[model samples]
Target chain A: MSTQWIAVIGTCAFAFILKFVGHSLPEKWLAHPRIGRINALIPIVLLTALVTINSVTVKTKIVIDHRMAGLGVAIIALYFKLPFPVIVLGAAVGSAIAYHFSH
Target chain B: MSVKRDSFSLSFAVGAYGTAFGAASATAHFSILQTCLLSLLTFSGASQFAVIGVVGAGGSALSAIATASLLGTRNALYGIRMAPILKVKGFKRIVAAQLTIDESTAIATAQDNEKDQITGFWHTGFGVFIFWNIFTLLGALGAQAIGNPSAWGLDAAVPAAFIALVWPRLVDKKTRLIAVGAIALSLVLVPFTPAGLPIITTSLLAIVVGWRA
Candidate 1:
């Protein structure tokens, strides 16, 4: 088999393992106070990593650009306690505008 | 109105980027089948783009895979958090893993109640998978008809989607601080590293900050 196929299969397998392990653990074990505290923090950290990686452009320049604009809109939505769709729309509009102006 | 609005908005928003991916894959000579498979199987936009970018840049398949894998590592962390919520055992775990992605995982984790989490996971995962696959096929088949994806600013769609996803979650001082720090660090490292590496580094930094705080 070629490397690409192998990589695909490997990735798929890895994904399966993650899902099974993630969803199968007992609630009692997960809901332990210590565990709950830790889990509560996971979303924040994971979201931070996901957002930074997705939004930031760190190549030769430090410009905030369109992604940041979207993020800014998202932040504003969250601050105002907007609903999910509102947050999404705000960011989309913000990004579209940012891209239009910057480019 | 709310449900219709949600569905329309999500479809339009996600479909815009999905169309871009399809067109790009077509331009790259990927068959509609291949593009569909990638969307259905991998189901990750950034990693898919990274793989294609490396291939387009003439990098080896191994390099492309490595880059994709690095970005995909985040899913594992998502899995760790969702492990208890998903009740599947034995072979079913494998099937569940295939379904887990950014949207489903995020929706599942964000809900305050158990029933909501389950419903969110299934609805988001299944909904995204169906829509993503359908749009990918549409994009691939209509690649030529769609014209230049860049002209539509489709490249910006994924980040926009991500912003929409992340923005609602930053409800506190610590999360906001970590996000700001991660972005700053990513900007500082971009010139010195490859496209996705800065994200990994910044994520680790965020983990440290979170742990410390």
Candidate 2:
């Protein structure tokens, strides 16, 4: 295998190892109030960051485009308690339409 | 119960998102086998994208690994939170750990009872795994047959799905405050930092908020 494949495999191993090691840690340690609370909140933080970065960044630069419109519509859909697929399709089709009009 | 329904829907939605990753890796010039392997073995969505993003930019495999590993670190954290509830042993532990990604951990924790949590964990973990891999092949073939995924706006699909996941969880003032903080911190850092770095840096805010909360 090439270096890229090696890296991919190694990274894959490292991920599983992290999961294994985490499971091995003493439950009492993670049970600490602060650690537990933060761990619970970590998903929110990570997902927020992921959504923001994905929506805004293109290459090395910050380019706001129809993706933002799609995100906006999706956020609105979320507030309205629209079912999941509608949210996904709304963003996809919404942005496609915005891109169609914009360009 | 509602939890199982949510788990099934969430897994299916996330599984369908493999189409985005397949198209993305294909667009980055990964061979069909490599794309499928990334989904199967690496299996984490953000890290897979990070690998493709880094490698696509002509970075070395080592650099790609480093970037992807940074994103994958959160799964370890998820594992930490889940280990108690999951409580697997030997080979079962390995299976549990492999399934211990963002979606599984989130859905499992959302449950009010331990039995339901375990059910949610397996349903989501395995469900996403099975569906995600199958759709990945479909996406790879589709990408090769068709043209640019971005032309069809498939690039936005993953984020769209992710937003739906995070939306329902923002249930209170404190959670909302921290999310707003994380997003603002991430956006401010976007211009100054590299592609994936801003996301990691936003964790600093999570830390501060978690500390103060």
lDDT (Cα, tens digit) per residue for candidate 1, span B1-213: 233334444545554566656655665455676677778777776566555543433334565565556556556556666666876666666656666777777667777788778767666666767777787788788765655443443334444444545565577886677667766775666577655455446546544554554
Best by DockQ: 2
Worst 10 residues of 1 chain B by lDDT: B149-158
Residue A74 local lDDT, model 2? 88
DockQ of 2: 0.50
TM-score of chain A of 1: 0.65
Candidate 2 docks at the CAPRI level of medium
Model number 1 iRMSD: 5.6
lDDT, candidates in the order shown: 0.58, 0.76
Clashing pairs in 2: none
Which parts of model 2 have CA positions greater than 4 angstroms off? A1-11, B1-14, B24-31, B45-88, B101-124
Badly placed stretches (over 4 Å) of model 1 are A1-13, A23-103, B1-31, B44-93, B100-128, B140-144
DockQ of each: 0.25, 0.50
Alpha carbon deviation, residue B111, candidate 2 (Å): 8.8
Error of model 1, residue A81, in angstroms: 9.0
Instruction: Write model 1 residue lDDT over A11-82, tens digit each, in one string.
Output: 444444544555554445544454444344444443444455545543333445675777777777767877
